[model samples]
Target: MQDYDETTAFLGQWGRFQQVVFFVLVASNIPNGSGVFSVVFIADIPRHHCLLPDVNITEDWLHVIIPVEVIDGEEKRSSCSRYRLDVVRNLSAQGFLPGRDVNLTELQQEGCVDGWSYSKDIYQSTIVSEFDLVCSEQWKQTFTSTVFFLGVLVGSLISGQLSDRFGRKPVFFATLVVQTVFAFVQIFSSSWAVFCVLLFVVGLGQISNYVSSFVLGSEILTGHVRVLYSSMGVCLGFAVGYMTLPLLAFYFRDWKSLLLAVSLPGLVYLPLWWVIPESPRWLLTQGRVEEAESIVRKAAKWNKVQAPQVIFKDYSAHVDEKKTPSIERHSVFSLLRTKTLRSLTLILCLVWFTLSTGYYALSLNTSRLHANPYLSCFISAAIEVPAYITSWLALRYIPRRVSTICVLLTGGVSLFFIQLVPQSIPSLSVALEMLGKFGITSGTSLMYAYTAELYPTVIRNTATGACCMVSRVGSCIAPFLLELSTFSKFLPYIILGTMSAVSAAAALFLPESFGRPYPQTIEEMCQGRRLKFPCLPPKQRSKLSSRELFESKL
Candidate 1:
């Protein structure tokens, strides 16, 4: 059968039709960026202490009712506990001063009976402040994010199949509505429970919209433009959205306003349902040949080219000829049937899990670092823009295996140095953390393309889905891992650094997939034959050593 690329060549690569689809579809990813990282601001916990109500006592005396506790070797008032207010009031009436004549620690203490008072220096309000999710309720803050990712995990497993069963355009637009509506409703959440439930629904929509758009763009565009739209275009849009979050959060300090600021932009996508067409490839799979032909003709018209009637006729005839005996749909079990595939699958799983954990651990923990939270988040998001750009350049010039390994190792090395940096030099520590983020982001971006190149087309979606599901397991654990900093400041970094290092080492065992044509079957992959670079001269290829030869091949 002739490839779709051959029949669709008349559509014109990078022409008007492809450009419109590319930019329109890529805009969908920007809101997904907000869904993924917005939790950093929404659930932020500012400095807080116990609230002491007036009991005919002076202001300074009431302030002294909250006992000071040693935190990181510095004295700060306890957040959850305060001295008995009645006793303190009596002492104040007798003109007894706290710590001067009265032994404050020896006095009776209890939980914050009058509730807590949060410092509004950085954040004007957050879920933490609004819902009193501090002290004994602090774990609720982290759990909110975990619940959102749990929804993402569920969505990733089903969205691909749904898009295939239905249509990309419908599923994409449907999920966009779900995301926009839920995000808007969340702004008026009556309680934390309502907010969390809304967040989960929004997460379901977020991942679904992103995946559907990705599939649609890949199926509609032609040649390198298709590849670039998948990687650089959407990836940069996501980064731009992520960077936009901090700026929005900075201006709209209230959690509700911030939520509204991020959500309302999704409404701009409402009109795209009419503008973007369904994937012609997906239509062919469902045997809707006439509809696919109509789209192809439209694309040709937009590109200012003539649609050859013979091309569509021949394509439809070819697809019809193999309708009964086409390749059977492969299951997840098929991936594990062969030894090489099973081993490769396991290695990829580890790489996915470890990379995801380390990536999110750093991402979610940004607010905890000693700096302006908004500035830190902006820096964190801004750094990824260049990282994705560098990843694109590396994929073109460097071997996939080499680039993946180097980037992972760079992240691991940065994590190892993070714990070693002293508290006195917080600026240096922040720089190393940003460096680690850059490395992890680049590796993650490359891994998406590398995994696609490693698998055969028959089981590619199944394999990708399984690996993505496993990766979400890491994200589910990431917030909890970050919560462990309360126990030991170095623990999260140490764990992240260790996992990244091991994954980097394991990457060496995988085969190079740089310039090689993607294997179309399981047997072809097992053969492990590295193809020669089409552009390289035979003399140069022959002069290289075994390792250099592998790199030269792509």
Candidate 2:
């Protein structure tokens, strides 16, 4: 790394401009807080309506029962008598109930009920019934969810490679344009197939928003400030998305309108092309040291400091010789051989997996709660804002490993309690769910910061991307896992909690990097074995030094 005084001069107020653009870009990606669209499309539930028989209810229990169908021999079977009390009440208000005991003839004459029994001998053989929805088909709904994640998976895997080849600024601009076009097209989609295609393209572009913002933020800030700013940006964006989604859903009941609300804000950032700077670190890596220096000087100038004479330093020699040639050529396989790197990759992957599973699983299951889905989602999301802030405070005072372990352990503990909490006590269940949200959110924010810190500069982006790919494995499994069993409600939490605890234990095996400068090369990272420094007394350093001194004297 280049050796220069800490006090470097800055140029014109480009830093402020960069920060503003960063904030806007980050905020625009907050997945519509109204979450109605996501629930309608991604969660695969649409046109949920059911009829109740012989039940009197109030308005408070609306939306209590969702209709479902079972398959019988060569026919579909359905039932409304299976409706929960809450569902009965909801349908009663909506005119989905029978005033007295009515057979199929009475229901058919009234024109309120549809479908026929397949078996003529109702008592002799099992009769079949099928529930119908007024909205889209189930297969179509599943396709939309699949396409959304596939977009995320592909976009994430491609971002690092694309950003490295083309500059971060270009990638940012291109993806923004692509996302805007696709998002708008989604508004006009006539079928689920068309919508999925549009959403996939939208997903591809959205990844650019995140990767570019993170790269820009890291380049502009220094040391712990880098971690703090990036984590806070993400957390704040999520919190805003969560808080706003409910209101957006309430106002714009139509899914298309909600998509428009989320997509339109992103267009405002396209004009930021003039302001956002290319990554200076990336510039230096590509051997454009002079250009890197110019960018750095501009940043310094903006901070009201004078730019010092810039010197370029090559720290590449310190990297393990074996890993160097392959990495320099951008070989993905090289990351597997380096033990330290491999360990870092595994730990990061586990962290991401746990976070995504816990976060999305809870989000998808909000429909199971008695309270308003919008309100519950909002509260769960609102809890994360404070979690991120608290994580920032803890990172400042505590050692990196300790904070990571604590947060993971906390999430694990909360998840375990979720299994024990009776569903009958809705209030307590919601509270515990919120607590789990807090722990997982805090752990996730910290993981992003910690993963960036652990990787060497040579393959930082690649390593982070690779770990994210593993996390997608968890994301892909999450929906299926959630659907496996009726008793599987707490399964995601259990799996996430256990994985987080395992990651926390693995963190103990990594070096403590607090107060120490970041290691720039693989060699520097691997030079010493990791140990518990926070638990060690300060006098231990003095004792070791004195012992060496006495040995030299002897």
Candidate 3:
């Protein structure tokens, strides 16, 4: 019975057909990068203050009507309240100048009677500016982003089941359309509520399309092509897309314009519907043998190989053999059915939760860094290029446990020290912040490969899915974490740093999966058979082989 791999071996490794699919699928991820991180610009709050109505005072004395407070170590006019206009007018008429004859603090303060004034130097408009989401309403900014990620979590959970039932190509295209249409609709939204609802739908489509593209590529590509597609192609494409966000935001400046600009590029991707093909593997899984055969034949012909007359023959028998191991399929709850699995699941969740939270916290804070928001965001996104490359190298050469623990620790240490960098040297703070992001980014990339390796194949998807969902919970909480800065300037960094450090320590207890065969069952995991290095004395090796020979003879 020939497996799909044996049947497709004649198509040759890294052929033109595989190359086409690789590039096309990788191209799909470029837009996803933008969609994922565009929130940085869309929700950023600019410098603002309470608006002062028509007063017969000079522009230089506008400070007389507003109180100043130190925020993040900078003396800035307060955002929420202003000195009573009547008092200020009476004082100004009496020639009672601010800081001269009168005490500014002594004046009664009240909320902005005429609304707020937003600084347009960096941004022309954002959701914060559009909806007055500042001061007491600041939670709305972070909550909106959380709502989007919540949508991502829901979308991720359903897309897998939907794609399994409906086929990969249809779900992929449907989500792509959903993403495009809703993204555009967000630009036209008349209110924040409408915009947020659209944003949630956009998040749904974003993850759905991304997952479909990934699954399609994995199913269709064979051998090293699949590895490269997963490790380098998709990650680098995402970084490229993320890097493009700052450049686009720099040009568009206005929130509406930036949203429209970044989103319209997805429309160009629509043409891929005509050229890209469905996953033949998915087709076979659904018992569409003829359809699967046609795609395989097309792939072979595209690679200049002769198409086989019979494909997937005896596949049912081979599938039965393959299916026997998983006949008693376990649900996600089964991950905790054993003490060992339960311990591993809990540790993995903590690790995933911290890494995901740290990653997003650093990403969302990019705009707040003491530099040009665009440059800061670009640096944050661009750094992931080298970070991912470093992670790949580490995964190849170093032990998985060592690499994961070290990366998390490095991120933790960097974030812990960021609080110590004196405000006198803003560059140092920014540098440390970016360094922390670099470490977390490397760890984030490593976790996907590392976590999958740790779980046995039967429950691997379920275990990883549960852990990833935990990460989304982290994602949901991160923006709110950023809001903690309102309580204390160093609180967010301290909290994220603590999370990183704790997770790194938890990683030490995880079994190392490096250079070892993946365990096939929960029993193998419970036995801890494959977790150790295979070192043995020469005498021991000889004795073991001799014993095996004697047993075979008996």
Superposed Cα RMSD, model 1: 6.9
Q: Of the candidates numbered 1 and 2, which has the greater TM-score value?
A: 1
Per-residue accuracy of model 1 over 446-550 as CA lDDT, tens digit each: 877777667654455556666776777898899999878889887888888888889988998887877655444454444454422221234533343332222
True-structure lDDT of candidate 3: 0.77
In what order do the candidates fall by lDDT, top score first? 1, 3, 2
What is the lDDT, from 0 to 100, of the residue 278 in candidate 3?
A: 85
Best by TM-score: 1
List residue ranges in candidate 2 displaced over 4 A. Answer: 1-143, 309-327, 485-488, 528-554
Error at 231, model 1, angstroms: 2.6
